[model samples]
Target: MRIVLATTLAVAFAVPAVAAAPARPARLGLCAACHGETGMAQIPGAPNLAGQQLDYLREALRQYRDGRRNVPLMRAAIGPVSEADLDALARWYSAQMPQTQGTP
Candidate 1:
């Protein structure tokens, strides 16, 4: 009886640690829709976000969030993001390799 109870308790604790693992932020998927998996923007007119300055990315998102920036799409896109998520995303993108426009 004691061994059975101990085993059950151990399994109960272990189950939650495996099941309740935190998921990656949702904004990362949103960013990937336009910006490639590597942070390089594949679509024309979309600026490459990879290797951008952290301050620049943060300020850009802030402007969109604050209604200072006039881009409706960007405003809607950034509307629900928390400041911490924005900073983390900015740091991630800024660390990627920058894409060059022309061939040598």
Candidate 2:
């Protein structure tokens, strides 16, 4: 009986743990299509995102999300992203090491 009670308690505690995995970023594939796998923008006119400030990135995304900034492409690109996804993307991009090439 004691063992059964202990097992039930353990399972109860473990349930929340199993359910608590961090939510994966949505729109990450769209982000990667232009930003590259590491957040370095590969397309011309796409701003480099690697190592950018989190606050700045978040603000920019917010602007795009809210129609404050007027880039149609960017607005469309960022439209579907959630706040948590923006935060996660900003955090992920800010940690990348930026590389620079000579100006063409």
lDDT of 2 by residue, 2-84 (tens): 99999999999999966753344655788888987577787987778878887998888888888999989888888877888
- Cα RMSDs of all predictions? 10.0, 9.0
The residue-by-residue lDDT of candidate 1 on 1-104, one tens digit each, is 99999999999999987675333445787777778756778687777887888799888888888889989988877776889888777777876777676867
Give lDDT per model, in order.
0.78, 0.79
Which segments of candidate 1 are over 4 A away from where they belong? 1-26, 101-104
Runs in model 2 deviating more than 4 A are: 1-24, 102-104
Q: Which candidate comes out best when scored by lDDT? A: 2
lDDT of 1 at 29: 78
TM-scores for every predicted model: 0.67, 0.69
Candidate 1 whole-model C-alpha lDDT, 0 to 1: 0.78
Per-model clash counts, in order, read: 0, 0
